[model samples]
Target: MADRKFALGTFNAGIAPFPGIVIDDTVYDARQVVPHLTVATLLADWEASLPALTAAAARPVGGGISLSGLRVLPPVTPPGQLFAAGANYRQHVIQMAVAHKLGAEGADPEQLAAAAAAEIDERKKHGEPYVWSGIPSSISGAYDDVILPGGWDDHDWELELGVVIGRRARHVPVADALDYVAGYTICNDLTTRSLVPRKDIPMMGTDWMRAKNFPTFFPTGPFLVPATFVPDPLNLRIQLRLNGETMQDSNTGDMIFGPAELISYISRFAELRPGDMVITGSPPGNGSHWGRYLQPGDVMECEIDGLGVQRTRCIAEAD
Candidate 1:
């Protein structure tokens, strides 16, 4: 068998969507060879399932399905305990703070980013990552349409690197945290910027639950590239374009806390189980910084190096 890298994705195969081993454009059903194989089962025993998946994926199997005709679903269906990071990127944190407090009235995106850069330079060297839980139902497919919730016009795009856990972890040390990672995928952490702050209760601060977890808020994965394929997750390029205009262009290196650090930090208080997804915070170039927000008929093209692309369209929710 020729050496080729394979990723796992969920696709509609008749009655329901099932996990399939994806190698390039062709998707092969491993269930034909390994009975009752699902994404949950594979992740439940990632170590053992990986080799089997690799072998099955590479085989010149009978009647392999074409990925084009199939409706791709979120990589991990009923996605495991989702934990998302906030203000984790150096520039993103700066941009978010500037827009939220000072407003982007006259500031150019570059000026705002620079001002944020200047102030965020004094960030704590030993700060902990900010993480919050999300429901699996909020997840949508990579190519899915995003319905902007009614009456909220400030929907924004936050292209983030998603980390999938392969092991049950608790109090995991930063140095050894990457070992618990199963694979990596792209996640668009959609948020409603206008709803972020709480005026009714100033002390309560951000309202992440209302701002972040709307339906189809998290567009995750065209594929789940195994950790082995991604030799250096920190160096990958992250980019997003709105209506063919480049919006966010940054690298994972700008993250104040890398995937390992974020995972390890979150695990200190929460037990991260297999299939759980950790959204490593987004980089700069959000709508808030640019003073633009999502509008109906807009197209968001999101991509991360080697992880494939997600092209999602936006539509206004009906009243």
Candidate 2:
């Protein structure tokens, strides 16, 4: 047996979704060794289950199945809570601000970018993350189709890094926040740009529910890579290709508030239990910023360094 890097995910061939340990291109049934551990349960008892999972992945590879024919499912279905950060990436925030600027019309493009960069630096020094909640029902599998709902057609993609919580955290300090994380995954947080800002009530700002929580809007997980494997989550590369064209290409190093700070900030409001998630904000390129949005038959491929890739197709809702 050899100890090596592996990921955790859920798969379905014909029956119910089952947790598996992924080594290279093969997947071994997790229940073969750890009968009591599902992806959700493993995170609930993450510290205690690590050794067993590691040993399981080290076993001989004969009984494992190939990954090609199986259907990938959401790693953790109906997680307890789903929290997300907004405007957290430096370049993304700046790009959005500049793109939708109501003032500073006379400034050059370079000048605008510099001014936005400076503002981001100031915000980093004394700012808290912009966090919001999402319903569990919106989650779809990595390879599933993203349904572009009717009555609102401005669907846009925001590929982000997702953080999975292992330990219960309440009012945790920033210094020790990372101790509660179990793993990380890829998150494709699709938004309805047309419904984002309430035209009915301009003072209401964003309507996150209508804009973000549509069914099958959140496509997540090809694999969940443990924190031990991702030593530097802040420096990983995040890239997204829509219809075979690179739309979003940036690094997590551009995040103004990292997972530690975001978690610490959120812990003050509610308890962060095992299987809960926090999606770090998206990077610089988004469909809305490019004046393009998801249409029927569009394919989006999202990838993060170390974690596996997620490929989702877009389908428009019927008339």
Candidate with top lDDT is 2
The estimated TM-scores of all candidates read 0.92, 0.95
| Total clashes for model 2 | 0
Q: Write the per-residue lDDT of candidate 2 for residues 1-319, one digit (tens) a residue.
A: 3457988988887987788889899888887767554688878888877788888777744488899979988887555589999999988977887787723788776777788888888889986789999988898899999999877668999999999999999999999999999899999998999888898999989999989999888899988888889999999999999999999999998999999999999999999999898999999889878998899999999999999899999998877
Model 1 lDDT on a 0 to 1 scale: 0.87
Best model per TM-score: 2
Cα deviation of 296, candidate 1, in Å? 1.0
What would the TM-score be for candidate 2 when compared with the true structure? 0.95
- Give candidates' CA RMSD values in order: 2.9, 1.8
